[model samples]
Target: MRAAVYIRVSTDDQVKHGYSLAEQREACCSRARILGAQEVTVFSDEGISGSTLERPGLNEMREAAREGRFQLLVVRDPDRLSRKLAHQLLITDELEKCGIKLEFLDFDWKDTPEGRLFYSIRGAIAEYEREKIRDRMGRGKEQKARQGGIPINFDVFGYQYDPETGKVSYLEHEKKVVVEIFNWFTSEDIGANGIAKRLNENGIPTRRRAGRWHRQVVKQILANTVYIGLWRFKGMYIKVPPIIDENTFYRAQEKLKEVRRLYAGKQKHGYLLSGLITCADCGNTMTGAYARWWGKRERRYTCNKTCQGYKNEGCRPVKYILADALEEAVWNQIQTWLMDPDRLAREAMGQIVGQNDPREQIMVINKHLASIEKGQEALIDVIAKGYLDHMDSIEKKLAELKRRKEKLEKRKEELLLAYRQREELFAKIDEIREISESILRRLDDLAFTEKRSLVRALVKQVIVSGRGVPGGNGLRFINVTVLAKIPEQKISS
Candidate 1:
């Protein structure tokens, strides 16, 4: 007869409760020896959680059982098999299906109905007890928070947390950096990346003292309201030492919003009518093209078919419109609309045509996503509190919550995209009348980059008609039309 012994101990179980694999092996092997086993094999998983089915030693034991390498298996206790009740029953069923006998020193193994009932009840009680323990630990943190205490040790860059006292204190060096980041974001024309680079050049150490300062870390510092004395903990904002004033923090937030609304992370190209021109003859969107002829470098808008890597199945006679002529025409048209707010409002009001508002559906998705995030935070809170003894169950719960969150977030993005253009158009209309009044006074005086941004904000696309007839002199323009976005207020607030 061949026999197998399985033993397991998580990191916490070994350190806190003194559960050792060597001790379990000593006892399980002795039990196997008494069972008249000629050959015995021992499988052990150390520092790995039993709440999951992905243990190395446990997998080897299951495989050995299936291959008939062991006709009998001995475990010190059912908890050694798995902390999860579902996994315990699954492994037990799998072993029985393979015709292997499972024997636990602390548990009876019988094929009778009463034995199965008692095993399932005991597994349920163990699982319930584990949950109660984690719940108690989580509740303790909440109770501490309710009593006006700082329970967690993770402080932001500008603050230091003492675990012994659970009190947060300001670190002078890091607080100065945090103040500088906020000042740069609010008062200077520099972006987050520029600030991060400046910090790295100054040899600034990160909060962890691990590596160079990251743009995300800088952004987080600027965005955190804790700099103004409000720290978010378990959905509650506790008071912390203020690193910066409220006005500076709010200004930084506004600047962040303005940056996102304008550039949206994409670098601006030099073309004025980029991604906004259509070839009327071939129904192809025109693209900007730059070419040097002799001593002259010229920019023009041409049909997509004329570009390299694209098949030349374009109009019978493809025409290239000079960038200067097309831009001047479009800019003049935009200046006219901006100068006349009424016409701009009328034209742009119904321009963006979408089926549903999507705001209601988006609100629903946001609520669902919030619920999923709350569940994830609760699980993380327990794990973060050093509850690694039952970490497998928490990990499983976190994974499930994250999967649901990703699905909801994906749906929210789709809905947001569907409503982006229309909402932005209407939103622009709401503020355009006053903005255009000021902007029109200096429209032509705007720089090339500013002009491109203005053109992108106002104009949707340009459609030019007729092809250039190869005349005696050169290619000549036939006609040009500008479709400027004049979003009007259609829906009520």
Candidate 2:
């Protein structure tokens, strides 16, 4: 009979209880040999958490057992098998299915009923330990949350709060990204799907830490009051770090509340462009309103302005587009944009071409730094030669040169950071292009106001100036201003 020995030692086990790897391996191997086994194969899971099913060595041993490489399996104790009862039961069922007899050096399951009971009790004790540990960790997190520090389940982005020290710190670049999303959604009146599609197109990772972004993530970002300095823990407000200004945040919330009110008690109201359309004439946003007519669904973008003073004032006629037709037009535009892949690639490459070479810039700055040092030394030398008449001028010149040198060195560092970002973007150029094409394709499939939402993502503002297109009847020229890539600016309020 061939025997396989499995051993596991967690970080906590090694430190607190001294469950050393060498001792476990020695005991398991000795016991397997003593059990009249012809061959012994040892499997060790070191520095692995027993709570998770990611143990490498344990997986290999289980595979070997299934292949009939070992007829008997030995462990130092039942705890070595697993810390969780459910996991232990699963392992036992798998071993049984493979017709492999599991053995514990401290347990004699095949010998007597008393031994079986002892093994069961030992497994229970291990399970209790794991539960205790889990409970302690959960309690610690709850305590931190109660003390005005956000509980760290890690879903919240933009800023990280250390529960131990209660020190809230922001990842500068990531925070800016979040702010951009918020601004794009509310101010630009972009829908959740459109925002998510644009973000995915720009190679932004999704909320699930997966390869793609989802509309739900966009919704969460829009509804998250935490960005404006309100921290929520388990659905209750706790601690927060101020990100956006209070006024802007309140306005965003107000818009969100209005959107919710508009869609209340209606099924199928969660359309892509539900909350983003604005009135071109009255300057009020067009809220989504629907009515059943002749057993057919009719959707209209109604201006929030109730007074119709301009109705008879000979103003530009309000053009109300059918939701479906609007969505179709937007989709057609997206399809046209993505059909030429070569153009998109060229456009992407053009953005990074004029960036300064960080290495050359650093070298130039270093030369200036050396010259400053030399100038300081020369000034000291002249002062030491008893020529103190122009000493003050020389000193001032040296100070100015030193400051300029410092500024250049700092600028070089900034250039290095920009270069690193360009390098990363270049590496993912192909992936970025593919993502962009996919986003355009997806946007082209949305209906009505949904299409308008896709437009809102790329556009900052759409001003309808009550001006009609040339040679067209009452068709107003919609002036669209796009929100292209811009250098990040720090916003402190």
Candidate 3:
């Protein structure tokens, strides 16, 4: 008779009960030899959970039994096959169909109805015992947490855990890494994606030390309250040792929100008229799109939701304009304005005639920025002077002030941009002519990025209104009306 012996144990079982894989294997093989088997094959799954049926050894054993590699399958216990009663019954039934005898050292096995009922009860009791043990462990951890002990596994990246003392402290090198991550995120203008790219380029190892850094990982580090000594456990934030200051941590959080808000719906691709073109009918912006057909690429501007399966019920029909044609039309207008600088300047001035000069707003923003800077300096000065008792309240106040300062700084940049554009509108005819001619010289050779910048600077909104007409070649021809930013005006005689 041929016999197969299977053994299994989990990491916790090995450590807590000294149930080593070698010990199980030795015991199972010995028991199989005593059961009148001349041939024996060993299949063992080490340090794997019996809760899951996806073990490699278990799969191989099942396949072997089907192939008649062994006449009997032996395991030390029913729980060794599975801790779940359903899984135990499933494996036994499959083995019976395969004509392979199933035997366990700790439980009796029989094919009779009464024997099957006893087997099921034994499996159920095993599962219930496992569940009871899980419940006890969970309650133990919760009680530990309530008593101000660390309830987590304590394998956090930058910290080292002392199992004997139940204490956690920073590993020096990893602690430095944590500080650098926070510093780079808060101080640099780059977002989490840019930081992740830099980290990967610098060959920085991730927490697992096997994978490269990712944007989400970097973001998680920034948003983790642990760096600021607040470790959240089941909605309760417990105190931990601080690595990043509250000021820097809160600033990074604010920056995360600002980045998401400001960069949402922004097209990063260099589409010349991306945010400039609008469908007059649907009021939706027509963005740049491309398709590959028959080994050739076609680029066009399209109302995305209407054509892209978003199923906009109101937009019954869709409209698309060739990228090349619309870009050429808009570029030609830009060139015409460039050749006649005085008329361009006049149109620019006319557009802003009623709007107030942005310089006054710029001045006010600068004053507020300066006041915030002064406040920041004062807080630093107080910290430098060793005022330590109320540091928590002081840090919170400083973080709030910094958040306000960031808002003001962002507004100042906007105002400054407007001020620069207003300055361009007021350029002298001679300067405009010189600059325009110089730009027009390289107009044809401009890169896509440069052309995009030029379009965004000059064109405010391009409204497209047209209907499609079927052409003779089984194609559609789209004719659209363009409402230019600078309408053609007859010069004063």
Candidate 4:
């Protein structure tokens, strides 16, 4: 039977047990040869977690198995296949179904009942090993959390965690985006849909893709406590590098509360405007109400608990507004504001408002290069002293200095790129600024669809006044609030 040898060495195992990639491959090959396999194909996954099935070598082996390239599988141990019983069982079941025999070098497969018991025990031992590993990890994370250290894993966006020092720092660029999200929701009172709409319109990068923003992405930003220098681990809070202060975090939470209250009790009545409308009287957002109006079908926005219960008190019951009518109003607003030539010009100019100065970046790079040179001289002097133990320590210092030097070189390159693109960057900034300025200049220039998009971007909530005032006035009082840092523009009289 043609046998495929599988080997795996996770990063943690490699560090703790000196389980080098070469050693694992050698052991697997030896076992496969000892088992008398006619053909041997090796599958190796290095520095990869066995918990995930995304390993490249594992995928290749599985594909080979399906294609009848191998009728038997050999491994150093069951753990090499998987530490999780579920995964192990699934793979073994699949292999059995495919008429492939799986053999473990450390495990003897005798035809007797006692041998079967041994096999079961071996699987149990593999599971125990996984459990022990998990327990140790959990304890370590919990300790780190309690000691005010952020849990170390893959770098979380908007955060920079130092593995050596166990300290966390915020990624400046991403933190700014996070702050903008909070400002949009709390100060602007923008809902999830509106936040998402605005982000997509502005070409902001989303969390899922390399450079795309979504509503869920904004929500995650708002919910994250890293902005406040505190993280929630297992439902408990641990302090870390703060992106925003406690006050801002609390305000964002309050806005989230309001959003939940707006949709507390409602049913879907239409698309687009279904979850956007809110009541102005009770401060409760309206829900979509659908029914047969006139001869054709129509959708309306209304409040469940509109006016105060008392007849003598509170604003009168508000009239239901058609979704299409409001949507048209919004689109018209967008065209007038976003597509205006003068406004676009102003925004293009404002695009480079917050760019890093080339001189500052150069200064930083020069400082790093100077330090690296000093470190190199020191390392040479230490080497000349002939102190073997001190030489080992100095070597590490020299290596670290070299790494820093490389990083500075890369930063210098990036600074050069930024300098080259400075003009374009400024134009881009002007574009965004112009878009915002145009909206302030001509609110009437927008078409129905454009206005809707604009409202989603600038105007968070539109408060439609309750039924006619004391003397039955026909005019409705509509109060519109804008997002953060947006200039309040005076409409041309």
Candidate 5:
């Protein structure tokens, strides 16, 4: 007789109960030998959970069993196969189909109805125990966060943790690197790639001593607020010693956001108005591309309906507009706006005042919702008073009420979100107004990304009209319409 012994132990099981894979393997092997099996194979999965059947050893054992390599499969306990009842039955059924008998050294009641019920109960209890342990650990961590205590398994770069005192202190050398990264990004306007290249060129080691510096690593270091003495854990912020000042941190954040917005999509050609430009014909946003025209590479913008998944259902224009001419025209118009600070300020202030108050609308919706709830309660009372004949009509009215309630609830959420965004929107308008002069002075000296950011902040959309034939000296009939970022107000009729 040939026999295969399987053993498994999870990390938590090993830590809590001192259960060893070796112990299970030895017991199963002894049982196999006592059953008079001459050839025995051992399969063991260590530090792997029994809730899944993806274990390497278990898979190999199943393959061998299917090959008729063993007459019997031996495990120390039923759970050594799987902690799930469904998985246990599945594995056992698969082995039985392959003409291999399963033998559990701890129990021989697998064939009985009572044993199957007991096995299912045990599996359920094991799963419940794992869930309870996970929940308890989560609650403990959240409690520690609320109490301002350091998390047990917390690990972050640029800081050293003292386990005994539960204190995190700045690593002096790493702290200097962090400050330098921020300064290069915010003050010098160096991008993440350039910063990473500089760090690697200087032979500076990453947090993991041997790891190479990466652009993503530099970006993460720049984005982390931990250097500003705040440890954010489970929605709680714990105060620590500061390494970077608030002003530098916030400026870096603003620069990052500006860069993200400027080059949001595929702007590989670095088109000035890639995301901001829209085709007046198809109403679809234009995408930047390079096309060869008469043996010359020409950068152009075209309606991106095909790329946007519209396929054959979009406007196909005869000719694409030159990128340089369109961008130059838009830039001149922005320059005109920048030259008039008074007009720009007045227009921005007008938009701000014209914006509707979302709070008032929310109050009105709430009042209507209260009335609906009262009507629903009255209908329920009428139905409860043995009004069985009105049940069908009442149900129809109730469903309609529910639909309206849902519609109003969704509207309320939208209004609330807009209300929350109102402050930030107004602040942006104010900042644009305040910096109008400074921006005009540096308009010519600004970098490509900076110019793009300025244009995106000030202009809502650039509607390009009329297509021109390629190979021409310039656009024959290029008309660019610039829409300023003005808030639209509802007109009372």
Candidate 6:
């Protein structure tokens, strides 16, 4: 007789229930030999839960059983096959259909009604235990979150977690990268795809040590509020040390929303200036669209609201501009700017110095914060002194004060962060000069995506007007507005 022994042990089972994979394999093999089976095969799924049949070993065993490789299937118990009653019955029925008899070493229960009932009861108990374990773990996590502690055993990109102390701290190097990501997205006009490309070009590894960065990964980082000192878990927010200022984070979010609105369904064309271009006449975003011209399909940027939909009724005579000509015109201007390091430095420094000083504002915030703290203390004193008549009003006032204090503190942090970022930018002006020189020297050698990133970093908007040849060099108007720091240039072709 040919027999196949199957065993499985989840991680929890190995730790708490003492059900090691080796032990289960040994017991099943012993039972297979006792059944007088000559050619026995053993299939084991280690650290695999019995709730799912997706285990490699289990699938292989099922395939072999269907091929009539074994006359009997042996397991330590029915729950070893599956903790779910339905799965156990289905697996047994499958084996029976393959002309294989199912045998349990720990019990002989499948044939008789009482035995089947006992098997089902054990399976029910196993499933119930799993649910209870999950419930307990969820409760534990909720408790930890309520206490403002790191609950999950996972690491965030720019933060380090201490499992023993349940404390989280910023990883300085990674935090700098996080801040740079926000700065590029919000200030440099680089979208998530551009950021991901830049990270990959710079050989920056992801949080998981992945060799490449994807657009989705960059998007997740931009959308995560954790960098702003708020950890959202199961609808609860816990405060942490913020990596990026709240202002920058929210600004990035607004940019993301704008990008979504502009390039909502036009990703397939891979337009270079999809979200960055605006129709000069309509004052609406110009989207990438195709038109039939001279019996050929030509790709062009057009104001969709003016051309297709009636959303912008004020727009008359819809505008369509050649995609390639506008992209090239903008790219050429950006390359020219990159080649001039002195101009770049002057413009960047000017913007940095033009920022408003936040010290006075921060001082005022501190005064209000102090007042709020005193008010909270006074409210607590009143409550402690058995003044129950106006308890509700007192509590409401305290809550309002606390909310105001939080806002003021958040504003102060933003101001301080902005100041620090300016100082850092001033210090790194020389490094920026060198990097721009390198990029300018190798401008033509960069890939299309890399060129797109460079253009997005330097140019804020590429306003297009009038029609031009689809693949030709002539365009009616192309205005390349460089970033706020740099002087805007209008190129007419």
Best candidate (score: TM-score): 5
Model 5 ranges off by over 4 Å: 265-493
Model 2 over residues 1-493: C-alpha lDDT tens digits?
7999999998998998889889988988888888889899989898887877679998998888766688889887767877776777788778876668887777666535675566667678877876798899888888877877656744467876575675777867668878887788678866666777687778876434565666666667767778877777776677567678777777777877877776575746544444445555666655555745457677644453323122222223544434443333333444544566455456667777776667788788788888888988888889889898987798788757755765676587798888888788776666646756766566546665665554554333322223334333223344322222221111111
| Per-residue accuracy of model 1 over 187-295 as CA lDDT, tens digit each | 8888887888788778888877867666777778888889999888888888878989999999999988888777643334367888888887888888776755456
Each candidate structure's TM-score, on Cα atoms with residue i matched to residue i, is: 0.53, 0.47, 0.53, 0.47, 0.54, 0.53
Candidate 5 residue pairs in clash (backbone atoms < 3 Å): none
Worst 10 residues of 6 by lDDT: 306-315
Model 6's alpha-carbon lDDT is: 0.78
- Per-residue lDDT of 433 in model 4: 63
lDDT of 6 at 153: 74
The positional error of residue 442 in candidate 4, measured at the CA in angstroms, is 57
**lDDT (Cα, tens digit) per residue for candidate 3, span 1-493:** 8999999989888788788778888887888888888999999898899999999999999888766688888898888898899999999988886668888887787789999999999888888888999999888888887777898677776888888898889988778888988888888777777777777777777667876676777888899998898877877776778898999999999999988877664434346788787776777778776755347666777774622112342334656566766677677777888877677667656787888777788788788878878987888888899988888887888867766775676678787898787776566434656667778888889888888887775566776656444343212344444444454421110
Model 6, 1-493: lDDT tens digits are 8999998888888787799878887888888889899988999898888889798999999989866789888898887888887898788878876668888877775567786788778777878887998899999999989998878974789999889987789988888889888989888967787888788778887887755677788889999988989989999998888888888888998998999987766555567776788766667887777776568777777775522112464345555676766677777777767778777778667766655667767788889989989999999998899998997899789868855875687689898988787777776777667878888777779977887777676668776655444344747444434332245666776
lDDT of each: 0.79, 0.66, 0.76, 0.66, 0.79, 0.78
